[model samples]
Target: MFDWLYVLMKKLVENVFGLSLDTGIGDSVHFFFYDSVKIIILLGFMIFTISYIRSYFSPEKTKEYISKFNGISKNVMASFLGIVTPFCSCSSVPLFIGFVEGGIPLGVTFSFLITSPIVNEAAFAILWASFGWKIAVLYVVMGVVLGVVGGIIIDKRKLEKYVEEYVYEMQMNRPDIEELTFKDRINFAKSNTLEIIGRVWKYVLVGIAIGAAIHGWAPEAALTKYAGPGNPLAVLAATIIAVPLYSNALGTIPIAEALLMKGVGLGTAMAFMMATTALSFPEMVLLRKVIKPKLIANFVAITAIGIVFIGYMFNGIAHLVI
Candidate 1:
């Protein structure tokens, strides 16, 4: 789909810039320009389309819809809902409280919280654009599975006592759902696209710059030695390293692309991206408001274990996909 852009960037680098593609500096410049443009374009289009679809599913409607289901199916719905809602980890907290206030199960709410940041239209589109459909599909499947499994485990453990008492006592005033015309939906989509792009564009640039630097100057043998498929601890190392860093999936994909290019194992790169986006420290602080320390720790431990398992699973099957 973006073959033209690649050719154009190559031409611009070698011709307009008068730099040989053989040089590391030239190659890095090309990578920075090509990836930055491609991702930005994908971000704009996908965000708009997803935001349009999301206009129909307001918070009230989402809460009401999820409340109707029960048991495992409820968790399933919540996980799927999380994919379309497109909330960042910190942003998802208020809704998390709303779910509890609405009498939704802690486990089901966790399902939504877990998946909301990790899987979304932007992430899926970027993955498909950067890698391929197979990887994109696999990522979505794995993310949803993580959410469902995490939610179920939390529910089975009977962790409701960990929630703050004030959350239950707080009565949420339900707002009436507004009926939107097609025009309204379009306008909302446009605004949302701009808002999201404006907010994350810097992260995108910084991520791409890091990726370009790694792509252009990093020693492949060194990366392969530490992060390659041969290293059994590579995935675990990546996940642990990513815990302190925070970025959305969109920002992390380019870095993952560079890591893969530098001979890093696919699973290792993905684990880093997932850990950064899903279990960010800011998200923990936000959740601390409504839940106690024990619950937060459990959530982190459960989710981290799940991510590590997924990272290893992806490594095991890397050959089939790559």
Candidate 2:
């Protein structure tokens, strides 16, 4: 099983990036690499399905109104919306910016931001179709829980005060932040959807490469050695393992599959994948361009803790029930 996962991940990285590292199985890699390309093409079709649907199906006026909710209700609401709304990081920043500029609460915005990338339509569809409704439902609920709790934690830390001075000055409480007209709403959604997909395509490919490699070559022994049952430090270790790698939204699929195949605990693998990819180094760098370091630290700390909790929570539940 370990060898199978390793072969899957290694071939993925090679094909996506044109990288050529020996997985010590020269001839076999060629075959897996071919299949990996098919996987990439399939994922591309799926990612764009969500992206274009956001353009065709959603109205901008509604988003404009919802974006203004700016409170805890809005946070959960945004999380729920994030489950279906297709967005990548770059596209999301502008939506996030518009909300902030329009005076939405930071915590509510965070909820939307976190959940959108982690719980896209493709993710739900994949889990639902492949795993079953129970797991799919659990995935959505946990995603919302992560976003809502993480938002509140960030808010309570008074981290809003740490937004870059420019962003701070930009906050408003205008009564006029209402829904847009139908034409304007649809146009807005379409534009934002396209912009987000365009900006994130690169990140997705990069993510797929890393994920593919992990799938192709990660050692089962290492997974069990580091994250197996009875390991009390597993959660923290998982977080630490995930910090340097990065992916966003759709890119996590291959990596997660590979790790799971290797006997890594669901919670631990998820914690690492979520932290490294969803709230990534590049995203932090981009955010720091707009937010203060203190705010960044707080954001990182909150999400990291949230992911760790998720890691343990799912692990405990899985063991108890299964």
Candidate 3:
């Protein structure tokens, strides 16, 4: 549906503007315009749909479900809930604090934290739009697996002792908000869709602009030489670089698409996306207020190892599936 729409839009733009969509600046323009429209349309629909689905459940319900699980199932439940919880990394600290104070295990909370930023629906939407369902499914599976494994490792180490003493002592008093009706949910979805698209469209444009420029002007030889699947260190390099950089997954998706178009390896692109979203210096710094440096270091190290493994694994198998 989107491909046909893109073709029609491209033709319309060409006819309306008296420009070609196949060559030089026109090619770049068409790529940017087509991708921008496609991504925004997908983003709105996906966000609204997910938000409407979310209306069926509440945060209290999610916590209840998370608290009920034990062992590996606990990690799984927490990680899955993290994807649907609708909180950004910065706001997650308060939830984490509340969970810990309410007697939820540290490992389970970590599971939630690990997956929340990494496997969001916005990222999923863009990945689906840019790379298709196979890769999108792969990304979600790997993200959840990373969360589960990281949580289990933290559980084994009995790292609850490493959490800051102050977190347990602090008391929170939150007022409950009323649940929304179906009509309210519809309104909420509309507002959320607009708000998200309004905030990120510039990033999308910038990313696509960079992508469009590279698509038309950059030399594929240089990109292929350095970040190609054949390069043994490309995945590692991408993962390492992404650790400190800070960008939302939505913003990074277009750039990753561009990199792939310019001949960067699939694994390398995946690793970069994982690193930027899953692990970041600011995230670590924020976490330090609640967790000791040693545990924080372990979290980073373990997550990085998993991300690198996924990068290499995907790079090796991407050609087979893609």
Overall lDDT per candidate, in order of appearance: 0.86, 0.63, 0.83
Model 2, global lDDT: 0.63
lDDT tens digits by residue: candidate 2, 1-322? 1346456766565776555655434323543454345444434555555555565433234366566665578778867776656565666555666667766688877877787766765455444432345665677788888888887777677767777667656654434545456676556655654565565556555544565565556777888777765576887887876777554544554455455656667677556656665577777777776777887787778878888888888777755432
Best of the candidates, TM-score: 1
lDDT of 3 by residue, 242-264 (tens): 87766645677787887898888
Off by over 4 Å in 3: 13-22, 170-176
Lowest summed lDDT over 10 consecutive residues: which window, candidate 1? Answer: 84-93
Best by lDDT: 1
Q: Sorted by TM-score, highest first, which candidate order results?
A: 1, 3, 2
Which stretches in model 2 have alpha-carbon errors above 4 Å?
1-45, 56-63, 67-71, 121-137, 168-222, 248-255, 319-322
Question: On a 0 to 100 scale, what is the lDDT of residue 26 in model 1?
Answer: 89
TM-score computed on alpha carbons, candidate 1? 0.93
